[model samples]
Target chain A: MIDAARERIIDCDWHYQDSFKEVAAYMPEPWRTKYKHSNWDDAGVKQNLSSFFPTSTGDRQNYGKVVREHSNYPDEPEEPERVREGMDFLDIDVSLQISHLILAMGGVNADDKRVQAFTKGYVEYMLEEVLDPDDGVYGLAPMPYSDVEASLDILDRIEDEEAYVGACFVTAGASPPLGSRKYDPIYERCEDLDLPVVYHTGGSGLDEYVRAGYQEMIETHTLGFLESNMSQIVSVACQGIPEKYPDLDIVFMESGVTYIPGLISRLDEEYLKRPEEAPLLDTRPSEYITDFYFGTQPLEISARNELLELCFDMIGTDRLLYASDYPHWDFDSPSIINDLPMLDDDDRRAILAGNAEGVFGL
Target chain B: MSDGLVEVGPATEFEDGDHAIVEVGRAEVGVVRADGEFYALRNQCPHDGGPVCKGIVQRELLGEFTGTGERVEQYYGEECIISCPWHGWSFELETGTHIGDERIQLPMYDVVVEDGIVYVDTGE
Candidate 1:
């Protein structure tokens, strides 16, 4: 039941660092044995085999340093109590936990079997330890992109559970993208289950930017989220995901507001010039994008309020879901919205919590 | 020229590619002289809260394609664009609209020069 007693402040993208050793206990059979035997902490194994995206060692450190200059957000909390304390500090009533380690699933260089093990283990760990709906904490079941049957089964397992509010679709390093026919079965199930698909972008995932020889986290972090989401949005539009599963709630997280205007404008321009190429699209691509939701973490705020006001007009106030992404390098405080010069009381309430309640069906 | 017009300075104070940020009523207005013409835009950028008028005023870049996605030619165009010092998001000086998206614009004011002194109609 929706809590009517207080003004809602739902943080749609909260996170904590994953405990790999603990997660291994939840893994199935031989993979569990393999993970235990492997030198999990070795820098090489962590970067190459375990992590989905391979970031430069020095640049990765620099990335953290650079982002920390923006805000004084607390470090990642390892325990649930600490997580709640951080949330309390931010005045966030509900936090949907997006796993930091599990986000690497998109670029994991391992085979399907191992990938399935990681996915299963991660969700189980999240459910068993992290999620506490009574306390307003929830998690998205990480869908194993390598196996359709397994992904559907995981959704089935979480269908009756109140804690699993959505299914995670990690976009980094994902081949064939989310719009491909192979992934349709998962989307169809998510629609049937009333689960939103949260497209979470990451930095340490095996992605095109990393492959292109970006040696600095500054370069990779900047382009990685923006470019990957752009490709996925384009792919989803051309493939007609909106038409295929109209009920599916699509949410793109992490990428800020500036990317939206340029991307949608370009997509609309291209669609107008070559309608034949994307016959599945009924109207302009920008229209389809506007229908989707966005998580406003690391919201780009500048001195000029009118620029952001124009962005809000373009995306519409209702479509934006406030996400703190707390305990990260550049987390946004609720005051970011509260302090916005253009947003009146209604706009502030909608972005801070109202839209998230509707989108997540909380 | 009227009670509302805030006197900036002598018209001769501004030269091509030069600008002056002046207080008009409660708002800050930038009176710029670009390409031998005078224009007034809000001191703030619409993209981010950058001091847009405080940045460079120069020619806009133009590009062309030749053959079937093969060769390309790039050069500067006749239009003047003011770039935000923060992120380099440029806007057309003539219209005060973002070059990439015309929907975004700096709040503009009318500039009047009479009897040697320049004035910005802040509409206060």
Candidate 2:
């Protein structure tokens, strides 16, 4: 049904659950022993999902009704074989399997050698467990931005592999955001490999602003992404990352598309007054945004037409890529844009597949 | 027959590029004249109940190009575009079709001119 209607459906945002146990298997001698006994949630560990109010969105009418289906545990991730069945059912041409917690906590929080251990383990396991078995599946190599050199080594190995589309640089549970000078080597390596650097953030990593102690999971889930993507995108513009690496194509995921234009507007206002702050930016901060792509899930369909207009006027037709957060409770359907009256044939085609092809160089 | 027709009086009432509300039964239809043609669409904008008939009439913006080291704004054909003042969603006066989205066509009434009088089929 999905394939017949659209030219090519490239799902930009999808998830894979790689447990610590899975990565530990690939760890070398001494680290393997430490991984077996280590607690992921130890105090000051700065790991696992950071949250305060679990029931944050207690104000919504359907707040209590947020129930996730499970075959085993409540959030039991479907095995790769079962996921293959689901993908075939959807007929999704490209599913970019993004990791949420694996690199965000495991590699970023781990020390130097452990960073190598976690990242390399992630690539090996994802290749064997997720992408290799299915033609429809594509992988995003999760590199620990904490250790740029090690990440470069891993990117060299997997970047040429046909199954791997790009690399993910998650902001959660990390230092200095995505576009920091520390991560420049990693960005340069990704650019050299001709792969897009995907900024996929999750969990409440910024605990300072979050009402942590008493807030519910709902709070972290709902309010967590407030500064998640904007802060990182600003980092890119303010630090002149786009000017630094014009060839680099960045894809910001899990954030809605409408706010980008508005964010750019605010950033441009600052740029006008503080032009000296970012001498590398040749145009408005938002103009630099046009060089990037965005994933659309959790799309607010209440006023879908206006949303599309905002995208067209600010982001352009090719900037918004269709994303289905598959297997998650709130996964957007592939046909989410099918009924959008604002979208012409060209707009629909680009969002569905063409845009992704350009970014991922598919 | 006067059945669904609203007597908009003489065609002279609406000159080229002019628009007015014609009340047929209880429904109000917006009557616009452009390029020697008359268009009748529901006065209310389907999107936000704004006065669609009273919106600004303009040409369709096809695109722009400045690659040759200079700015050039371009347009093709005369699509009598009326933009909703509230949200700025433009609609084509002739077909009552939205400029961007094809699915959200506005309610259009059939307009006929007999002799010199303008009659709108409000179809109430």
Candidate 3:
């Protein structure tokens, strides 16, 4: 019944993991010993997926069991079949699949050749295996954050590759804001190449959280997504990336949309009060913000109707893109729109597919 | 409920880049144009109560990923700004929510264009 609409459904946020053996293959000798000794294997990946679904009542009680059990060995093997199954179930037309461990690419030492090797391996695997045969599947290439030059080089090499859509950057890492002079070359390259940058929610690696005495897996997991993206948005805006590049397209993946309207408003106000701080910007912060795109999933329907409407009013319909954080615990698909009582047919259609077409060039 | 939808104005009355503030019951709503499409949102700012309908409606740049696969650039769209003529807090006209306060959001209304006339749902 939704075939026509389904064909238009482009999932802006999806994930892919590496196989245990594949990861083990690239680990340096010292890390390989640690990896093998930890008994890091594919079973852990299956366990993660199973825990995400919690099919049975007993499974629900064991919600955090998988994360706890694999705390020391959190890596997972990529299961391409499981991903395909998810796409089939959701009836998605296209999925923007991000790297699994790629989130850690940010923290990897730039001087380290091993980081580059691993990134190459991951990108190659994704292009050759996951995306090549499936027209509906697209890869968001991972860059080596340890070395910005190396990252740009990798992007250049794969820029023309089939099924390669854009690049993914972890929200929290040692890398400066997208606008910082340190990242100018990268932003310029993306601006020149026209690839959109993706800032995903996870991949903080928990170093700070662990230091803060936070041990609960759920707390770490939930807070990681929220803090990472929120800070990234603020950093990008404050650093004046929008003004510096003026053309850099960025997407905040899996970060809910409810907070965007408020964040942009605040940024604009602060910009006005302290123009010297963001001297490069010629317009209000929100004006530059509309230039960027956001993928909405796990919509916070709990927000008041006026609030949701207000967000749409501020953000504009074209700037908002639709997404299904497929296979995740809080996966939200097309049906979620049906639950929105205030949205009319046009609003619902725009959120469902129309906006996505404009964003992804569908 | 009002038996008939409130007639805001003639569709042609609102220029491509303009907006109209219509009174429905006790509430004022805003209708604006962008990319040849019309959108409506509540007239009140979500941050501090302010008249958003009178806010400036302008074209602002939005970022886009070009086909080149490396460069990202900006594109413009119609945006409504309700600046608190007092505090100068600007809200995006399409969404009634404040710029940075995710906690507060504005109400949005529905508008329709027919035979060159603009009509708004008064919740009637």
Candidate 4:
């Protein structure tokens, strides 16, 4: 029952998250044991629930309105049928999956094997329930960054899967930068397999954002995702991810598009001042962003048309992919794209589908 | 005005895939030996004024991309490429042209070999 939504729109970012129990079914041994004891509703795993959150941001009256409108959001983020209804409402065609509860749930604490278990569990369930069942569904397998061998094992299994769009990670908490030699094997595998590496913020189970001087949930929520994307973008570009693995394409998800122009601009400046620090780079810092794609969700909208267009120009329309961070509190709708009066027909088409078609080989 | 000759080194000094920077008149030229031939280019990168001479040299890569629902890999030739150390702007060492943009190129210098020596005509 899709509304009169465009059939061509690919929701570049969406979630089909399953709980620990769902994941544990396919998980092996100790991790299966761990899931039995895991309590997702514990204060530790709670998202966007703070005693002072509603009090702090009440002036922003439209706050949480969209999530409120859709009763299924956040709670049923992983429910495929429920998700399909939202997609139909928005008229979204393909919705790419990037989950948080599996590999990253352990964050920096889980040892390698545990992380791998969580990942395997999540992907196995996804295969059984969502991706295998839905034609328009594509997913990025969650990677356990704690162990190289574990990550490789998952990739080996999924190498032939058409539903496997790629692999997803936030930045590893204390691991080497994404461009480090430690990750070369993974990049090499991705290169041969023809899957792009996808990174999104607020994963890794860390939720380390509360340490960033923002006490209220809104403040942490607002800047947390942005910081994760920003740091990795710098880490990879400056450290030579593109040069090292020329064939591997990377996509940054859910962080709004505004941060890209500034980060790349700063990187270009920093490279000019201290070229020795980043000897791996073969081109200007800005050029690496050309090899990458940015997801547009919680897409930026302001009265400032020129600045928004400036971002579109800076990254090129071909490099930006439309995303709806769907089923989350701040999910952007496919309908809002019609509101982007700054873009032309060609640019809109590219952002909506063409860019993704090229990026994911959709 | 003839910039005369900048003696890069003995031909043996640069094996295949070897590169060295030599002083040429008012500028420094990077001379690379690839596939039994010596090639030289100005050290200055046109993009962001990077030191193009002090970069990595490797075979031109034929990489993976979306085409016909599958990934493809095939190199154009055995062309050697030099990538700027600051950021990864790759230029074909033989032509000084960036792999993506033909117009964005490093200034090419002439390399001539006589006997067992490699010389760059830096055209001062």
Residue A28 lDDT in model 1? 91
Best DockQ among the predictions, by candidate number: 1
Q: DockQ of each candidate's interface versus the true one? A: 0.03, 0.01, 0.01, 0.01
Each candidate: how many clashes?
10, 12, 43, 9
Docking class of 3: incorrect
Per-residue lDDT over B12-114 for candidate 4, one digit per residue giving the tens place of the 0 to 100 score: 8777767788777667778887788888988876643446766767777676666886746655567778776433567998789999889787888888777
TM-score, model 3 to reference: 0.63
lDDT of 3 by residue, A128-246 (tens): 66774256788787766546887888788787775777777777564564455776677778777778777777644543442465534456655666667877787777777877776
List iRMS for all predictions: 8.5, 15.7, 20.5, 20.0
Q: What is the DockQ of candidate 1?
A: 0.03
RMSD of each: 11.8, 16.9, 19.3, 26.2
The true-versus-predicted C-alpha distance at residue A333 of model 2, in Å, is 0.7
Clashing pairs in 1: A52-A107, A52-A108, A52-A206, A53-A204, A53-A205, A53-A206, A302-B49, A303-B49, A304-B49, A307-B46
Query: lDDT, candidate 1, residue B32?
Result: 89
Better of 1 and 4 by lDDT: 1
TM-score of chain A of 4: 0.87
lDDT of 1 by residue, A308-343 (tens): 888889998999988977656456767678778788
Please give, for residues B56-85, the per-residue lDDT of candidate 1 as tens digits: 888887778867866567688999988765
Better of 2 and 4 by lDDT: 4
- What lDDT would candidate 4 get against the real structure? 0.71
Give the interface RMSD of candidate 1: 8.5
> Which residue pairs show collisions in model 4?
A107-A204, A281-B87, A281-B88, A282-B87, A282-B88, A282-B89, A283-B87, A283-B88, A283-B89
